[model samples]
Target: MHVFYTPDLGDNEFYSLNEEESKHCAKVLRLSIGDKIQLIDGRGGFFEAEIISAGKRRVDLKILSRQLAYKKQYHFIHIGIAPTKNIDRLSWFLEKCTEIGIDEISTFICDRSERKILKEERLDKIITAAVKQSLKAYHPQLNNAVRYKDFIQQDFTKYNGNLFIAHCEQDSQKLFLGDLAQPNQSYLVLIGPEGDFSSEEITLAKSYGFKPITLGESRLRTETAGVAACFELNYINR
Candidate 1:
């Protein structure tokens, strides 16, 4: 079944698909009235609906049934990474991570970060498409870009989860990400930029109780490292 995203879907019996979604459904997909389709509200609500009016600019769907999907109890994964120089790499990471499973994403600019700005609107669209393509009921929260120092200063206690920063710097007590992430627990992992975090930044993170960890022996790119950390956390929790 083809799935469409409708973040504002609520208790309404009839919902109108937005202009973009309507074009995809009525023109691009050639869907007609009476065709059944799935809709996700991005808040865990999934609806099975039949098209009532296949208008090119405003398709209408009548809800037939609704189901709520919930995430794993006590397991939430949040990844914070420096945006890569190539925006495409970051897009790939967002798509793959959402497909696998990610609760939240935070992009921060580090001292060594090559890219200082991101297209938030485009990134949000990518994430929304990923959610629909992957059949995920919940949409991962994308946080606004901020500086590394300002990001670290946020209230970590609210997460009530373990925090880790992955870096290549030689740490005497560095542990593998897979071994460090505990099951049925929340996690927040930080991935540095292509040039990696500065020594002082790493120290600052350590001072804030962010455990210095290693992804593996092989050094990965910024986006690759973010996806790797996300996968490890999700894998261990599962």
Candidate 2:
């Protein structure tokens, strides 16, 4: 069944697809009246519906069966990383992480960050596409970019034990994230930029109780490290 993003689809029997979705349904997918389709509210709402009307501007459907909390993951994965130099790589990270089951994302500008600017709108579209492709019941939350220092200093009293910072800097005390993260916990892991987080930045994060962790032996790019951390957290919970 073809699935469409319908975040606004609250409790309703009949719904109309917006212009963009309508165009894709009518022209691209060639779906017409009486066709069966699926709709996701991106917040645990999964619905089955049959199209009643189709047009270039709007597609109306009568929702049949509705399922809530469909395939929702148990653990919460929130990754805070610097934006990659090439946005395509960042987009790849976002897509893969969403497919793998991430709950939240935060792009913080680090002291060594090579790319300071980001387009949230574009990133949102990428995440939405990934969610549709992966058929996720929940949408990942994306936070606006903030400075690493400011991001770390915020009240994380909630994630005291689950908080981590993935850095390349040598630290004998550093533990593997896969081994440290416990299941069903809310995790917030920070990743640095191409140049990596500055020593002073690392110190500040530690002072805030963010323990340093290593992703692996091989050095990873900013985007790759973000994805690696995301995958490790998801994998461990699995």
Candidate 3:
């Protein structure tokens, strides 16, 4: 069955697809009336429905059955990193993380950040597509870009002692994230920009109880670091 994202599908017995979705469902997929398809609300709502009316402009479906919290991850993974100069790199990072199972994402402007602004709407669309591609029921929350200093100051009560920052700086004191972090807990992993974080930024993060972690021996780009950290955590939790 074809899968479609319908984030706002409330408890209505019948649902009409949006214009873009309608065209894709009817014209592109050529799904006709009585065809069955799957819908996800991106909040852990998975639904099965049969098309009642199929048209290029509109596709109406009658809800058949629904399940909540479908294939939900027990652990939460939130990665905060600096945006890449090329937005596509960030898009790549988002897509990979969403498939690997992330809970939330935030972009923070570091002292050495090359790109400070982000196309959040575009990134959101990429994430949505990734979720549907991976058949995920929960949509990852994407936060707007925030300055590094301000972001580090916010109270992460949910993550608690799981705060960590990954940097390119070669420090023997830095511990492997895999060894330091415990499993099945919420995480807040921060990755820096192309030039990595300034000494001052690292100091400030440590002041807020953010432990310094190493992704690996080799130096990595901003987006690569983000993906590495995401994979590292997910691998550990596995």
Off by over 4 Å in 2: none
**RMSD per prediction, one decimal?**
1.1, 0.9, 1.1
Model 2 worst lDDT window (10 residues)? 153-162
- For candidate 2, write residues 20-57 as lDDT tens digits: 99999999999999999989999999999999999998
Model 2 pairs whose backbones collide? none
- Write one digit per residue (lDDT tens) for candidate 1, span 136-212: 89999999999999999888895564899999988997898787777888888999999999999999998898998
Candidate 3 vs. true structure, TM-score: 0.96
The C-alpha TM-scores of every prediction are: 0.97, 0.98, 0.96
lDDT of 3 by residue, 196-233 (tens): 89999988999998999997888888888888888888
Candidate 2, position 157, lDDT: 70
lDDT of 1: 0.91
- The whole-model lDDT of each prediction reads 0.91, 0.90, 0.91
lDDT of 3: 0.91
